[model samples]
Target: MSSTQLRANDPQIPSSADGSQGLPLLVLGALGVVYGDIGTSPLYAFREALHAAGSPSVSFARLEVLGLLSLIVWALTMVVTIKYVSFVLKADNKGEGGTLSLTALARESFRGRPVWILVLGVIGASLFIGDAIITPAISVLSAVEGLEVVAPTLAEWVVTITVAIILALFLVQRFGTERVASIFGPITALWFLALGVSGLVHIVEQPSVLAAVNPYYGVRFLVVHAEIAIPVLGAVFLAVTGAEALYVDLGHFGRKPIVVAWFAIVFPCLLLNYFGQGAYVLTNPVSEHPFFEMQADWTQLPMVILATAATVIASQAVISGAYSLIRQAMHLNLLPRFHVRHTSETQSGQIYMPQINTLLLICVVVLIISFRSSSALSAAYGIAVTGEMLITAALLFVVMRRIWQWSLLFALLVIIPLAIIDVGFFVANVAKFAHGGWVPVVIALSAAFLMQTWMAGRRLLISKTRADEIPLRTVIESLTKKQPLTVPGTAVFLTSDVEGAPTALLHSLKHYKVLHEKNVILSVVTSSSPFVADNDKIFYESFTPHFSRVIITFGYMETPNVPRALVLAKKLGWKFDIMSTSFFLSRRTLIPAAKGGMPFWQDRIFVALAQNASSATDYFRLPTGRVVELGIQTTI
Candidate 1:
């Protein structure tokens, strides 16, 4: 079996294939892609936390600064380092890790498909999409807002400049990021180095700022300020918003590289920066933008420029992640198929989706223009991140108990506190609903609703079609007794149901009154795992002298290329020729029913989604000229 096909519980599976020689390079790559979100947090996390504790105009006491800093420090340590790096990373499905990957792993522990687990996975994925849309808007806005500090005269142009940069970023996504991606590591490394050095200088000025490292300060602040704790927790969560990338990008760069980068470089630098900001705030108590103000006047403009670049890289990581997540959703049958364009010849993971990119661009631009400031958008950000984190914690418990075979007591002991922390953050963010938190909530809910509708609608359509479909065995028996005029070439009928006669095949017989010399019933099956082994890709069975069944299995993380997979049939004793073959597909035209399966609104939504979905020819990477689509109008 391929390494990717191994179960999560297998002890022999290696965490990564990159050996010792490649470790350093992998670490560099992790810095750019994995840590982009959290690395840029210093720009506004501390400031937002401070604003939440008291008025921005108020000069907080030394204790308040230390307390807030303490909370930020431990939040990173507990949430990112412990929960993700040490624990969640071990629950990877085969060698891949993400919300959906974990969901697949957990579902595999059961005897049959479980509805609750599927719902959790859908919700987790939906919340992540919400995060993807908001990250670019807020990260770039925060970085560009530094212009207000640079000139104060450019404050009016901040939104305009931000929108222009965002527009340019989305426009270039079509060309692929392979070339520009090389510089991401170096640029991000320099950004982190700057963060450490600036903070170290301030720490030297007042060594006392390091006191925030103790948990006592963080605890004391929460106890004393209980009334404001919810808002404060929500704001502090901004510090670890991008922590999910650690587990999400595990397949790209291994666990070791991400952990090493976080502990050795990313973590220390973030600490220095947060401490430096706190120390700077102590001396210059009224500083509103301490991140830019902490730097010397000569370096402030350069800092702003570098910060903008870092934020762009952060946006890129999340945007790319969004593409990967949506692809997984499509393969798992949770969504209608979208046109997926592979941007790199060698790397299957490098993909670009035009429809997704355009939608993201529109939503992001609307957000930037409507909010007009990073602080305002921050109100809408924490809800999605916290909601996703909570879902991960819930799924982790199931994996521990069932997949790993851990004792129930042991699993509960490990997961409960972590879940509680997640709940705290989630509840805190929920408090911001009227204040703008409703944005991500609305986005996530809408995405989840669409996914449910698609899945439900497909189920109904399948059931309805199956009821009308003739049994393939019966059809083959009838053909044996009375054969029609045989055509010379092969005809492959594509279907979702392997046992039922394909609608196209049945229609062909009724209309043309002819049969091909060879007929193959082809069905594509998506595996629960991320990638399937080539050895296990094709399943073939011959029903009669002229009829056979071919099932091609693809992993949820893969793009289904029917023509390429069909080539594997040669190994199963079937001669496959793309040039001489004709592919038949049943094109569905869905009409909403007056009563039954779904509500009127959802039925309408499902029909719209079906209409907009990419054609099977494009989605399956089949040859366009050899394909014949037969339209079948159906109601549900």
Candidate 2:
């Protein structure tokens, strides 16, 4: 598919208004949240860069420092700014972005083996869940690690205060972050600009330090200090940790604005400050300024406050990103379904998932106690970041071939370099497994299991229902007729797909044993895309069996709200109010049954997820008072 053909087909593809205006906020939020992994790298990026040599005592040459700064700058420019921002963000699913949305795209284009694409998609999405598990722990723990720097004696209370804050963060999550969210962009923007301003002061003071960008600093450091540099990559990689988060958040910001913010604001500021830190260290090697040390005495308190604000914003982004990821996971069959509340009345992007919040809160508390310092948490961060990156690269390859239709030569040229960087990061991060990095790997693995089990369980349930299912045509022919059993009202059973067995329809007919004279529509909600068009949504067919089936389509980005949909579809069908209609919902209960049975472990997994899964009544936004539930038992 050429870009022109893709656009021609997808007139709803995000335009400049969406990418430029909406994306910055989303990008900022993601940067704020995801950056917690790396934004704090300045605490270590340069300090560790110098330690790339055998000791911190080496004579700091101007060239070495400049080269390191350039590496940081170019890495951000090439990786974050160019590779993802300029390209990847364009790959949206009906103007939404997430791993599964990309998966949906690949599914539509590949049109071949779906299981392989699903495997890759699930791995990538699950890795983010792993990050959701670790980010709060590492992020808050890292920030509170600052107490030791700002005041060493307060270090004893770091764990206590950090845990308190994380607990409180989750506790208040239900109230929503609208008031706080508005300021996320401005605060982060200031943090970057302030960093730049502070760096410029130091850079002018030691102009010679700018030469470190000459490549020799990074190159020579690797050559002369291979032993030390081996471990240092772990820390340097942290500088770009938020880089992937920016791409993950593409749905919020349309890629263009995030790209602008990165190039015009974020990139320059981060580089200037990093080099400024290098400059500060070059001139006064003995100075102990983790971040605020570079500031003048009068400015230290404000800087501390600003840094804290920025850190919180960064953490907030991760927290919110967690909610967003969990929602996507539920929709895509990667996780057990859960209650997801749209928190922001105005912005659909603002969402809340209680299950994830509690989980994150617990993990953060544990991290604060176990690690007690950012250094310990650093080990666990790499695998989640790079593993997801590799998954993204793999998906990107599929996108280029099937959707973008880029030539094999071009795809290989791009993939080889990304693979090298991605694999190196994965291998290096593995060295930290003993330290605490195993935690995220464990989390990601568990998340993947939960998701896979739910999907497997659901598939099994549907298959069993089909086996027992009386075909609609047969049922209608035998039972449905113009007779004394004519019911005064209509009963509509909602389904996800048309062909499969509908337990709801079976339950409705079994219990009621009547047909309405006016209108009784068998509605199936389809994910609207290339398969179906929005205008041609209200299609119906009256099989000779007296059953009129209606299939309605909605885009991926559109959250299904049944009542609103009914109203939109009113013109074509019976008036919702006058129809005297009642909606029938059939809920599934997971239990261990030898009939249609899954493995024992899988059974337990489904039961667990089913227990946690959100009620369908709430998810559909159907008039709660009017919904009648028919519970169907299934052995997973």
Residue-by-residue lDDT tens digits, candidate 1, 395-491: 9999999988999999899898898889999999999988889998899999999999999999999999999999988898899889999999899
Candidate 2: list runs displaced more than 4 Å.
1-40, 48-70, 287-289, 480-484, 518-533, 543-546, 594-597
Residue lDDT tens for model 2, 228-323: 554666666667776766666666655555667666767777778887887887777654444567777676667666766776666777778777
Give the 10-residue window scoring lowest on summed lDDT in candidate 2.
1-10
Supply candidate 2's per-residue lDDT for 622.
73
- Which window of ten consecutive residues has the lowest lDDT sum in model 1? 1-10
RMSD of each: 3.7, 4.9
